[model samples]
Target: MKRSSPAQISPDFRRTRVVDQTGIEERAARFTKRSIKQSSKLQALYQVLNMIDLTTLEGKDTDQKVRQLCYKARHPHDELSGIPTVAAICVYPNFVRVAKKSLEGSGIKVASVATAFPSGQSTRAIKLADTRLAVSEGADEVDMVISRGKFHAGEYAFVFDEIAAIKEACGKARLKVILETGELGSFDKVRRASDIAMHAGADFIKTSTGKIQPAATMPVTLVMLEAIRDFYYQTGKQVGMKPAGGISKSKLALHYLVMLRETLGQDWMSNEWFRFGASSLANDVLMQIRKEKTGQYQSAAYFSVD
Candidate 1:
């Protein structure tokens, strides 16, 4: 079915239900309380590894670093058997070429963060150019930040237009719009932003840039998931979700998967529907998997530092 465009969505759509913050906190806490069997934990660890966007987004990102990160994405652990490669390698636009080259034929995608990244204060022309450059460099996916300044200033139209523009600039590349939920003030605002991003044609609505504090908390992620759910029901289009940053531990990652399964059902449980934006999360999950296999705790020293 042909989905409705962003223009067809009204302001009323952005006005999400008054978020129940206390209830949300309690529910999020309950997600962590649930435990898994050791056998199931091993399978979930592999699933976690495959869904990771092994990332290195920074001012210090180098060709060497990008290549190393790509290599890690391709071969998460040389010593481990039957370990699947990660979903992708996320890098700055300048390093897209290096990541693309290194990740060739590994079925690992190259993702670039454009639209001014942690801050979307730049002009649309500049942001489009940034996205185009990444696509030209072979980025399979483009992660763009929503204009938080505009969103906070009650400029919802501008925010929606910017994301739609970047989605066009991405060409054939998938677009992941980062809401930076931590900077959006409250869960209600987070829901509003998520609605805007999805209707604006975001293939994925992400929680953070991993640059902000309090990125991808369970409550925030739950709110975004709910937004995606409502959007899908209204438009008949499935938008992906990425809860980036601060999800470093394996147990936390499992809790996120549990949340994914419970909130959106198993249909949204795959990498095509969900992703984790982290540099060290791969290692932590790997360590946990190793621990389950050998009955001995593993060290961070053993895993490749990407």
Candidate 2:
């Protein structure tokens, strides 16, 4: 798990990898066409439930909100009987201690967003302090945003060094690098960012911060997954993928799973290697599971609105 310094990373970030947009779009579309048996659908639904990172990131967030989110992450649906809890509870750095205490012994991790979060427009000193505070507060994972401005300005070395510094600041906690692909403006940029992140020591490459439009499209995720697949082939190292934002339906989650299975095989199937950074996605999955069990769908009001 040794991380590469900026000096060790390739300087040619402008062309780390080029993406074929038409082929990526067509391939991504084909994944949705795969037919699933009812039994397999149910299994996928449960798997989706387990792979979710129930998240709550907002300016008006309160201690009570983090606790409630932690409760949901631990319980999910008490009546489901044998249903698995979510993989983690993601929140702001200030609430990491609250979420950590609330999820004690439940096996659910507390993930905090750092590095100025959605904007990532701040000094590197502040970003490292932000990461350290979360880890000190008992966060099991740190989700950080790469400096999109620097990346766009061709300051790839700065971006790589920042991530490596944050990875070091994370101590024992896992680091999830948010590429915020929505603003990258092209599939080629997304691929380049993904390569930079994995090389700079990102435990996971995330699609978005959930604050931007067009977050986590199948085509974009496909590009990132393909980057991960290629990087693994070259380095024999495994990196996780989390397509955050805009994915709230069970069918769409199943499509992403199909793509992951086909692209990365069974080694990356678990929550350890794949995650959905969508809180609302949990409710939709629960509804699907209940529908499968009772032959009917439950009203959305039946679930908590955290």
Which digits, one per residue and each the tens of the lDDT, describe model 1 over residues 123-206?
Answer: 999999999999999999999999888898888889888888989888889999999988999999998998888878899999
lDDT (10s digit) by residue, model 2, range 207-231: 9999999899999999999999888
Give the root-mean-square deviation of each candidate in angstroms.
1.9, 2.5
Going through the candidates in order, what is the number of backbone clashes in each?
Answer: 0, 0
Model 1 residue runs over 4 Å out of place are 1-7
Q: Estimate the lDDT of model 1.
A: 0.88
Q: Give the least accurate 10-residue stretch of model 2, judged by summed lDDT.
A: 1-10
Candidate 1 has its poorest 10 consecutive residues by lDDT at 1-10
